[model samples]
Target: MNWLTNWIPKIRSTKSSSIPENLWHKCNKCGEMIFKQQIEDNLLVCTICDHHERMTAKQRLCAFFGSEKCFVVEEPKKYSDDPINFTDKISYKSRLKKYREICDSDDCFLIGIGSVEGKKVVALSMNFKFIGGSMGRALGNAIVYAADLAVENGIPLIIFSSSGGARMQEGMFSLVQMARTTIAIKQVKEAGLPYISVLCDPTTGGVQASFAMLGTITLAEPDALIGFAGKRVIQQTIRVELPDDFQSADFQFNNGFIDKIVHRSKMRSEIIRILDILD
Candidate 1:
């Protein structure tokens, strides 16, 4: 076990200084090398291409609410672990343990009660790093509870959606979340509170079909992928070719699926402005 963990550092060491591999980041869009600190300062957007990189749920919370104001809202109820006893290459339980450790979250969804620019809000964000932000029973339960909390407190709700879709491991139980989350958002809407959704990159599949698209005001990061089906699959199914930028956020906004395409730099102020209007 010690050998498995210790071999890499020894292999990469140099005579003068250890290589700082994590000190720099390469922009996925522009292929530009940027300092990790610079990326952090820019809220993880690529400085050159202005590409909005996926951020952890905690990072999203920090960006919106800052450390002092944000308080995590506990899930109202815990869901069963390995409800399906699913296993592929590895057990679903093992996968959960791995992602829980990596993302520092019990599930992909992070729900928090916080004030954004002095207005109290319930913020729900997805961490794509955890199982591609897959919507499972825990996440479904979290969203429903968060919606209830927002309604109970008379506060608005905002969800930052960055997901690859439903968790296949949970089978039909995962697909059912599409309805559960949709109904949850409706509860918030019925309370006459604003429900805003910020669609991040790769917001697709069951999530896009559900609460992610049910926002009162739908906003997306520039150039993010916003679609239900993959381009290749759609083209194949329809037996026709698709536009090069068919599923891009800009394309979706032009086609009216999104209300606005916001840049990462102005996201905080834009959200605050909207909250102020609805306040």
Candidate 2:
């Protein structure tokens, strides 16, 4: 009996296995259970519903430009990390530190230079993981730098915007970025270079009001939320019921706010096609 008990213990120990975290993902749209690898291979889109998931700035850049062909541009070193010394339960500097560790980025915006089909292009991708991709001084500087770099290299500029609007911690500094980024986009347009804007999930607030809408060819991912204000806010303000799909990519395209609805899989080719046509 003792020998039998010892054998059973050994068998139980051998049978036990730990499942790693993040091995599976649940699609928010369709509630489909998908393997993490499968979702990533599909560019984070849901296999069943084709719902596009939010991607990190670096992920988007690598996906669009090919990791081997992309080079990151450093963010400006002079901008203040906490301009207004804001504090709400936690200091702004502390919040920045936390998100920096989480995102491994200096700010919400990331700039990179890459070759798309052998044509040089400067791209700016916003990281919504970092404080909702809030527009701030650093982001404004990065936008200006990207625009200038595209102009200098005689290349096109592309901006992928996914933001909740302006950073409230930065106060007026954040609000002013809308104007600054607008001016930067204007500079790119003046240089006669293409400035393509790709609106991703939840592009709203000051971002949509400014450069996100000022693209030479504005593009949006399927089912992306694009608008100046949220549906609830707009409805409350206007005192009218909004459409069921208000501010969706399809809705915006129908209303002529967006030029096209692009899928993540076909985005690179579509951009290349546009570049070739413009070239």
Candidate 3:
């Protein structure tokens, strides 16, 4: 027992009573404090309670694959920044450059296949950190690729959707991506493969209008804000008192907008079971 106890670090002395400073992140949904690195290792899940934190597309992909073996959906072909160059907003080139510096990628989505709890499947990961995971050309392309991969590999697909909606900078072309994504997912349904979508915090706009809702099974993290318009806008439009938790994950679950409200700890295992049922 003494030998086993030797591994514990010995404290030289008690320090000042002041609490140690810990870095914190303000959750978009609940406005809670979240520790940074600890959350990363825990699938970006909040440690205090188990709320699913917003994740970047890259971080999400890495967690899903669990390694690099997952086939990457390479940068799309026929993609261009200036679908229509406009000086009214930031120039296409400048916006791209800014996003590139922050996100280090042009795409808001990553689609590919790999094993999770021993079941193989295709998956799409949306990065909330990147321009609010707006569904632009890159996102639409990734969805299409995931659907195609499911058809090609004979595996079901799962998408973790956390986005704000369309990329307005791209104009009408951005809106078109919604149609393209919906049609692409139709291929998966036609192929007789299961398509599951896990909606995290704040899945809205063009994404909500299209593929996010098309999933045969739509799952949402508890208390996520799932809607098209801001709460303020809704109140202004309706001119009435909204429910205490209107548009929240729990509300959606009760209203049939969400199929299931899942916890972060059980997510991977739940996905595994879904894949098993499909197989």
Candidate 4:
């Protein structure tokens, strides 16, 4: 009995099986715990509340074009990585490196060429994981390049926008992207090709002010926050209390700011339908 007690103590002291992190995810809207795999199986939308979760750029491309049909376009070589040599708490270059490693991306914007329901399209998706998907020289270059590629191929252009705003690190260089992207969208429209903007959660700031709102057919995920300025900023400036759902996708849709509030599951099909109609 004494020997058995000693053996039990030794076994207890040994390493125990560790539980995997991120096995379960809490739904941001409903506060329900759901299996992570289940969330992925449902296209990253919460099973309980149907709240659309943010997705990576690659995930978005795969969702729309499937793994086989999606091919990432090479980033253009014309833009400076840190255009203004800016720095804050950390050097802008260091921040870029950190995010690049964490996100496994060259920049926030990922441009791809893919086919949706047999129709070719140039797709650009923003990775909010990379510094809130802020617009800068890289993003501006990507947008212009995507637009040019779409026009050259005579294919539709699709953008999945998930951003906080322009990158403040780059100062005016970041703000210039707003105009650049807008011009890119205009070029796409001038070519008479469909330009679809899919606003995911938290599309705001300079992004919302520019190309995001210029889509020929704009669509948003349910409950997405799409606005130029933050709600708090607007409320403070106007000195009036805003509605609870002020910048929500539903609110924008109701006010005719966006074309539709689409469920995550229906987004692909809806885009395909719109493409067919445009064709």
Candidate 5:
């Protein structure tokens, strides 16, 4: 049998330009096309529509640091690789290997310290683009370590939650992160430092069940999804249709699950206000 590679085109032409495409992402609110780097500079907010797009953990840290002068707390590197050799529709190891080569990150979490609006704050961002932002042991460790560091420094802890929930590859190990992260947030709270969690689009599953819900002042992007379980799953179990905006930021705000619903343009001011109030 001939391999699929045999059918590939033999004639190839090289382009003259080498510059990468200035990629653009559309805003869900006002349907505006935003430059990726510009959006990132504005804390992932669409400049035209003020729509907030969820960013990678590293990107979030960079924005927090660039916007506010602060230092970083270097946490230990996290673990990666398939623990159980898991396979669903695809092989976990195979997928991991491919992404590893592409993204070069084994885990989905990154923790760093920075100032938000001139107030010292710790940040933890969940990289949703990486394996759907699945939380593994290293991610859990980063969360715990960040929380502990915040407590040690007597500063606020801020976490950007954007995840598909626990990593299927880690099995029970991933499930344990829920508790690990929650306990870490509590550790910060016990020290009397504010714990602010930002719920980005699709903050659900293990993330919503843990520290995302326990923030001393929880803030969510306009129209973010925040919930422990999905609406469809809940509806199927309860045999009833859910509200139109179930698990949305509006729903969470109305139900008092979150402190406020802030737009991307107003996020900096809102965070500063929270810091002032806490101070």
Candidate 6:
């Protein structure tokens, strides 16, 4: 047995590298190993299973704007970094700093002006990588900025929502954004500019309750999660087991919560067509 154990080490050493690390991503839904470049070309969707992967705000913007440069709108000023002086395992200020460095973004909200298929539009997207895309005062202000920009320019506005909820560190101030953003969207509506909302995966919590659902036409990626609460929480509260597809974009579309469930491949063309028609 000792000799066999010694020989096992030698045998293992003879094998090739087992680490599946470089330029390949395993699909979370379908468990398919796909090349990174292929996934990027496919808009981060799995080729075999057609699973839509989560995208960063920057990636989503680039996809919509194509290879050309899109002018980014200046985000509104943020409140104090640690409004409540919030602290848990780590301080809120420190966490913000860390996440900013990790995500390479000032905040979760990214506002910009970009041409989509030659139609100029005002755009805002949530960066879920930054603290789960929690909506704070900065994001709320950004939404207002985008809305005002659209209203002022008489251009269409599009928002990509991929948030977990309101920023807990900001407390009530964060929750206040829900109302603020809704009001801003209402202003855009009153101005007669189209406000399109694209809900990405895991659009839930305070975000779903507000602007994420207030689009002139609500569209979601295929199989993306869209709900106010988690399945477990809802089931526990309602005292019933949830459906297999509960909170999914398909489920939402079937139930009329979502206007359409667009696949990533068709998203750009669809948006362009809709913009043309609306224009």
Backbone Cα, N, C clashes tallied per candidate: 0, 0, 1, 0, 0, 1
lDDT of 6 by residue, 1-279 (tens): 789988988778665455444768999998988998899898899999998888888888878877437666556766667878899999999999999999889898777787876799988888889999999888888898888889989999999999999999999989999999999999999998899999998899999999999999999998888999889998999999889999989899999998998888888888899899888
Strongest candidate by TM-score: 2
Candidate 3 local Cα displacement, residue 11, angstroms: 22
Q: How do all models score by TM-score?
A: 0.92, 0.94, 0.84, 0.93, 0.83, 0.90
Better of 1 and 5 by TM-score: 1
Off by over 4 Å in 4: 1-19
Determine which window of 10 residues in candidate 4 has minimal summed lDDT.
12-21
TM-score of 3: 0.84
lDDT of 2 by residue, 179-253 (tens): 999998998999899999999998999999999999999999999999988899889899999999999999999
TM-score ranking, best first: 2, 4, 1, 6, 3, 5
**Residue pairs that clash (backbone atoms under 3 angstroms), model 5:** none
Q: Candidate 2: which stretches are off by over 4 Å?
A: 1-18
TM-score between candidate 2 and the true structure: 0.94
Q: What does candidate 1 score on TM?
A: 0.92
Q: Please identify model 3 stretches exceeding 4 Å from their true place.
A: 1-35, 68-73
RMSD from true fold, candidate 1: 5.4
Q: Model 1, 105: alpha-carbon shift in Å?
A: 1.2
**Residue 86 miss distance in model 5 (angstroms):** 2.2
Candidate 2, residue 133: lDDT: 94
lDDT of all the models against the reference?
0.90, 0.90, 0.79, 0.90, 0.79, 0.88
TM-score of 6: 0.90
> Residue-wise lDDT of candidate 4 within 138-224, one digit each (tens)?
898889999999999999999999999999998999999999989889999999999999999889999999999999999999889
lDDT (Cα, tens digit) per residue for candidate 1, span 1-279: 699678877675662376565889999889999999999999999988888888998888888887734666656688878988999999999999999898888999888897766798899989999999999999899899999989999999999999999999999999999999999999999999999999999899999999999998999998899999899999999999898999999899989999999988888899999988888
| Ranking of candidates on lDDT, top first | 2, 1, 4, 6, 3, 5
5 or 6: which has the higher lDDT? Answer: 6
Clashing pairs in 2: none
Q: lDDT of candidate 5 vs native?
A: 0.79
| Candidates 2 and 6, the one with greater lDDT | 2
Colliding residue pairs in candidate 4: none
